[model samples]
Target: MKNFAYTRAGSLSAAAEAASAEGADIIAGGTTMVDLMKIGVRNPDALVDISGLSELEGHEIGADRIRLGALARMSTVADDPDVIAAFPALSESLWKAASPQLRNAATLGGNILQRTRCPYFRDTAYSQCNKRNPGSGCAALDGGETTLHAIFGGSEACVAMYPGDLAATLVAFDATVATRGPGGTRTIPFAELHVLPGDTPEIETVLEPGEIVTAIELPVVPAMRASHYLKARDRESYAFAAASAAVGLEMDGDTVRDVRIGLGGVAAVPWRATAAEDSLRGSPLTEATAREAGRIAFADAQPLEGSAYKIALGADVVAGALLQAKSRMGGE
Candidate 1:
């Protein structure tokens, strides 16, 4: 890593101000930031340590909502009894992400802000990654290692997938992100936090410079008790998802009362399958209906030569997740 000035911010205000400095980056769990720094993908001249800020260190689980501190470790959230009981999708997402050691060190805030696992973006050896270097051109589109690339939200500029598990489940649950910036604190829908590559792949997020995420807020989701997150990968442990689904369903006997679906490892952002949810609403929760919902979810997919298989794979993943979630609703 490059030599950089380090300072610990005593308060959120102080952290915000410090983060505004040129090439200054915030360091919380240091899982994503440190790895990017070491790989030369991110070379911040200054790192503002915010891990000591007690204001963003714990969680608040209420009957109506759940507020997860940005600094809360992934393992901590996964192991919380309240989270496990009320939000099974959220708990499962964290538990299935990364490895046990990484889960213990990764923070909720950092995980959402984590960059794409695109090899071209991480290895500076590639000279054509638009995300790493704007207007430089994207090699992944023509390079042929696109099995892991996006099939839903891709443009000519970039096709990289957003590699985040928690954000997918949070999007499924209609979560909001709390952030502190130079102007003050504000809350935005979690879905809007990540921006599509479009023409400007370099600008990954909507956050203004110097803004630091404070917490992730999830509204009370009664159906979330029957939710589940299932990931399909090449191997089991320590492998990134090829396609994953976070699904929540509320059933009244055989009919679907409510539904939420979020897809991962197949889009530029955490994808909420609203159309799929609409199709499944008020319908019987049967295997055929679930499969149809999954197929409808990928109606707009623009698949590349190598990643076309993901459309079918993604459909099956979503359908299986829906069935799994429904099974959890037994006796409820």
Candidate 2:
């Protein structure tokens, strides 16, 4: 890694201000940032450590809404009694993510802001990645193996997927991301925090230059307790998702009353499957119906050579997650 000056910030505002300066960045868990720095993908001259900022450290797992501190470790949130009881999908997403060691070290905010795991983008040896170098070209699309590339919300310039599990579950529940920037503190819908990989593939999120995420808030809802997260990967442990789904449903006599579905490992952003929700809402819950809903979720997915199989795998995973969620509705 490059030699960088580090200063621990006393407050979130101070950290934000320091990070606003040129060649400065914020370090939370140091899992993602440090890895990128070591790989030469990111080289910040100065790093403002926000791990000690008290304002960004606690959880409010209340009856009305759950507020998760940005600096809260993934393992802490996953083990919280209220989180496990109220938001199974949220807890499951974290538990099924990276290994236990990583979960203990990684913070909630850092996980959401994690960079793509695309080989071309990570390895500086490849010179054709547009996300790493804007307008350069995408090697993955040009005869490069793209089994893990995005099929939805991807432009020709970039096909890399947003490799995170927590954000997918948060998006499914319509969580709000609270941030403090130069202007002031504000809350934005979690869905809007991540941008689609359009022409500007390099710009990943809606967070302004000086903005620092403070917390994530999710409203307590009846459906959330019955939610479940299912991931399909090549290996059982320490493997990225090949296709994953976070599903929550409110059922009325075997019929769906309301539903929320978020798809991961298949898109540029944490994909909220609105069409799938539309298909399931107010409809009888069955294998056939769930499969149809899954198909609707990927109606707009444009797959490349190696990723074409993901379309079918993603649909099956969605269907399975819906069934799993429905089975858990009895407890709620």
Candidate 3:
């Protein structure tokens, strides 16, 4: 890693002020940031450490909403009884993520802000990685390894896949991210936090430079209790997802009252499957209906040569997640 000056911000305002400087990056848990820096994918001139800011720690599970502080450890949130009971999918997403050591250290803000796991983007040896270097061609697209590339939200400039678990559940539950920056504080829908890999693949989130994510707010809903997040990977543990689904279902007798779906590992951003949710609104929550919804979820997929299997695998994951959610509905 490159030599960089570091400062531990004593307050939110101080953090924002320090991070606003040119080439300064924010560091909380340092899980992803350190790795990227070591690989030469990210080389900040300075790091503004905000991990000591107590204002950005802990969580609150209220009757109407759940607020997870940006610095709240992933394990803390995943192991909370209230979070598990109220937002199982959210809890599971964190649980199924990295190992116990990582969960203990990874913070909510850093987890959402984690970059892609694309080999081309990580290895500086590859000259073509639009995400790493704008205007550079994408090596993953030019007969490179594409099994992990995005099938949705990919443009001619980039096809990198998002590799987070919690963000997908947040998107499924319509969570909001609160941020404080040089311009002041604001809240945006979590779905809008991540931008598509369009012409500017290098730019990812909508967060402004020096903006610090303060917290994530999720509305408490009945359907969320019946939610599930299913991740299909090459192995049983510690492997990144090949295809994953986050699903929440509300059932009324044999009919579906409401549903929310989010897909990961197959898109440039945490993907909300609105079309699939719309298709299953009045339908029964059965294997057949779930399968149909899954099919609808991937209808617009534009898979690459090695990633074509993700369509089928992603559909199966969606179907499995929906069924698992249904099973949690107290035999409804």
Candidate 4:
């Protein structure tokens, strides 16, 4: 928000070097960064804009994975024929995310890296938010209702949830995030990118300062063709989820051989509901089992004051999402 020097790098390495230095930040799509700046939540001394780097541009949807360019716009990825056909969950999450203009300007990597939608953090009116100032304490915990706060991996300190929808799709598909820096290239599991707030909400990810995301790779799954992302929000459209489910089920005849389950709106990160997934992995695909799996996903969720509905809503979400996915199979 304050006056900051800007540099547009020609290469990823150049961008990394500029960003890795002191008080420098990376700006790819600039959607999230600009918003944070406007709210006084982000004030960098200098910004290294990496949107110009050719090394971080373009993509290929493969049989094993969809190799995503860091700079690929959300609209482009959502509208790609292969993405629409092969990854219905991924495509749907993108399309359901924001307005058309926002999707056009927001890059895929930036969307995944976007921050929480927590009101206290966004407003900057509250001076006691620990995420904004360490040791300042969290006002959301005692002052506001925590229905939208986290139920997993939350410390007494903070409960801000990861507010991205696309990340849930990536988690369901077992995706990998690719990054590059002076140390060369390394790929991290998408699940590992986000960390629970625990005691440090300011430190959101593992990316060292100055590192630039190169790509995100999602594993291929035939189940994805039978997958769906169901978001239960306050409204039909243009609203963040109240509770959501991403489900992909593989059937061996009438029985399910494998299932991938990921949840949103109830946790600090894109939650891979392995317990729910385990419930459905080798069982018969029935509405009962799907609902039970949904129940298992939230078994460990400890709602604060008002979010206890997330437990029931989360169960219905998984059930609804799985049932919707099953109906999509050809000749179902």
Single out the weakest 10-residue window by summed lDDT for candidate 2: 323-332
Q: Report lDDT (CA) for all predictions.
A: 0.91, 0.91, 0.93, 0.85
lDDT of 1 by residue, 114-229 (tens): 99999889989988999999898888886647887899788999999999988789888889999999999899999999999899988889999899999999888678899999
Best by lDDT: 3
Model 3 per-residue lDDT tens digits across residues 1-332:
88999999999999999999999999999999999998999999999999999999999999999999999999999999988988899999999989999999999999999999999999999999999999889998888999998999999999999999998899999999999999999999999999998899999999888899999999988889899999999987877889999899888888899999999889999999999999999888889989999999999999999999999999999999999999998643
The prediction achieving the highest TM-score against the true structure is: 3
The alpha-carbon lDDT assigned to residue 268 of candidate 1 equals: 91
**Residue-level lDDT for 171 in candidate 3:** 95
Regions of model 4 farther than 4 Å from truth: none
Report the alpha-carbon TM-score of model 4 versus the true structure: 0.97
* Model 3 pairs in collision: none
Q: Write the per-residue lDDT of candidate 2 for residues 1-332, one digit (tens) a residue.
A: 88999999887778888888889988999999989999999999999999998778888878889899999999999988888888899999998899999999999999999999889999999999999999999999899989999998889789999999998899989899999987789999999999988889999999887789999999988889889999999998878898999999888887799898999999999999998999888889888998999899988899998999889999999999998888886622
**TM-score, model 3 to reference:** 0.99
Q: Model 1, poorest ten-residue lDDT window? A: 139-148
Ranking by TM-score: 3, 1, 2, 4
